[model samples]
Target: MGVTYRRILLKLSGEALMGELSYGVDPAVVHGIAEEVAELVNEGIEVAIVVGGGNIFRGMMGAAAGMERATADYIGMIATVMNAMTLQDALERIGIPTRVQTAIAMQEVAEPYIRRRAIRHLEKGRVVVFGAGSGNPFFTTDTTASLRAAEINAEVLFKATKVDGVYDSDPKKNPDAKRFKSLTYSHVLQQDLKVMDSTAIALCKDNDIPIIVFDLSVRGNIKRAVAGESIGTIVGGFCEVC
Candidate 1:
């Protein structure tokens, strides 16, 4: 099979790491992700990841409860680091070389985020896991994914979520909800589709990077999507299967 993207960025949510569990990282899910990533590495793909911290902590939730915005965001960033470490351990257990990097200074546990160093790590066939959402408040991990993807010149960004793909409406509630096969960045932004945040979408649009959104619950979906099997909705470009 021809690989559609040789260099890709995988954007994983902390909640995505929580499979069936109410909160916190699920070992099985992490292991599954690591396996998929390993498959890609074996195929000679350069993969990078930016994980969210929603499973462990949500800055918005803390802010709703009256905590200082910046403080809550910083705490949430730390939560991402925890998730990243767990993922790194899972990958390394299976003989995959991995690196955990953070935006904020945490030299004891992870390397500080350096664009050149990260690119070199990818070139060396190591999976780089980026944690901490931009090291600033009011920025989401989605934005971080887009920013990092652009920085690394990734060919595409893959978003693995619980849902199968971006729907016109909540598929669970609306039986007739529509799932798009392909959409332009303008369409996603104009409709406010839940593919990603507006800023993230805009960043990708500016960089002309395509995004593949698929369900993480299904094993092998990552590899299938990477092989251009078209198992999900694609934004910013034509569907690979099409």
Candidate 2:
């Protein structure tokens, strides 16, 4: 079947790349993700990804450890670039055309981010992977994903996570916590649900972009999400059918 959304920006946390490991990227995990993304591209869906670096280094953690805030954030950005490069390599190995665009200029590794160029890349059917978290300090990759999704005019933002969907309480902690099939941006912010940062949620709300929080651990979840299967929490807009 055809996908419901034409173009989508997938937000992947660095921790998602670590499969059965405490930290660091697992080659097999990266390859699996690449395979999923490749399937989307083959189905004629334009795909872009914004990856986080929490598994390698978290800026907030470093700041708490007495490091300079800006310096620590920069380090975190660099770590994201590394993850992006690793993902790019994996996608290319499987014969998927991909490009790594960094917010911070890294001429030797990837191209510097350019808005028009990124849109053009997607038009040409290349999966553009954005790295470096907006090239600024004090901003999380969640915000970067939101910003990029808007800039690229993506139809939806897929926030991949371990949980199947957003719950009133942590499902791991509260077995009775109800999962939301669909929610409004106002509800998420008012309840302080940890689906995405406030900034990211607000951005998507303003842009009228729908955010789907789904379980990435499931093998075919990505495809299901792109296909508009009701397998996760849909935020920003409510649909009776969803």
Candidate 3:
């Protein structure tokens, strides 16, 4: 069968790297994810990733205290850089050609946010990792994911979540929370599903990009999503039928 989704933007939460361990990057877990993604690359899928920094720092969390908004956001951005570097090392360690592009300017370390260059890397079969949350203090990585997905003209936005799919309620708190196999963008907004930040959902909706929420914690989920297996809740023009 032909490979599905020629280009995809995979949004990975830093917390997913924990892998049942402490709150940090787990080598085994990162390597496993990299290998899975590498398999998809082998199948000719162009992948670009936007990694969240929640595992290291969340500006809003500290902002609840007396932390300055700008300061806290800068810290959060740095945390994303760290996660990006870690993921870059992991992916490259496994022989997958990779590039780390940052929103913030860091010429000595990584390349600045160059949309053309990032797209070129993907076209040349390199995994591009986007870091620093849009290079702005107020915007979140979720928004950044949507923005970059559109910029790159990706076929879909693969949102890597802890759960397998979007549920009517918090699946962690309510075991009986019904899982949705798929969903339309209007349904996600109408039902008030917390699949993504409102800003993120709005951006994707306005741009007509599909957002696929799936459990990245499960092995091979990334590849499966890229291969268009309908493994998770897809939000866009189509509705998720029961």
What is the Cα-based lDDT of residue 203 in candidate 3? 91
lDDT of 2 by residue, 1-242 (tens): 55799899999999999988999998999999999999988888899999999889999999999999999999999999999999999999999889999999999999999999999999999999999999999999999999999999999999998889998888889989988899999888987888899999999999999999999999999999988899999997774233
TM-score order of candidates, top first: 2, 1, 3
Off by over 4 Å in 3: 240-242
Q: For residues 104-176, write the lDDT of model 3, one tens digit per residue.
A: 9988889998999999999999999998889889788889999999999998999998899889999889989
Query: What is residue 203's positional error in candidate 1, in angstroms?
Result: 0.3
| TM-score of model number 2 | 0.97
Q: Clashes per prediction? A: 0, 0, 1
All candidates: TM-score? 0.97, 0.97, 0.96
- Candidate 1 structure, TM-score to reference: 0.97
List candidate 1 segments past 4 Å from native. Answer: 238-242
Candidates 1 and 2, the one with greater lDDT: 2
Show the colliding residue pairs in model 2. Answer: none
Q: Name the lDDT value of residue 112 in candidate 2.
A: 95
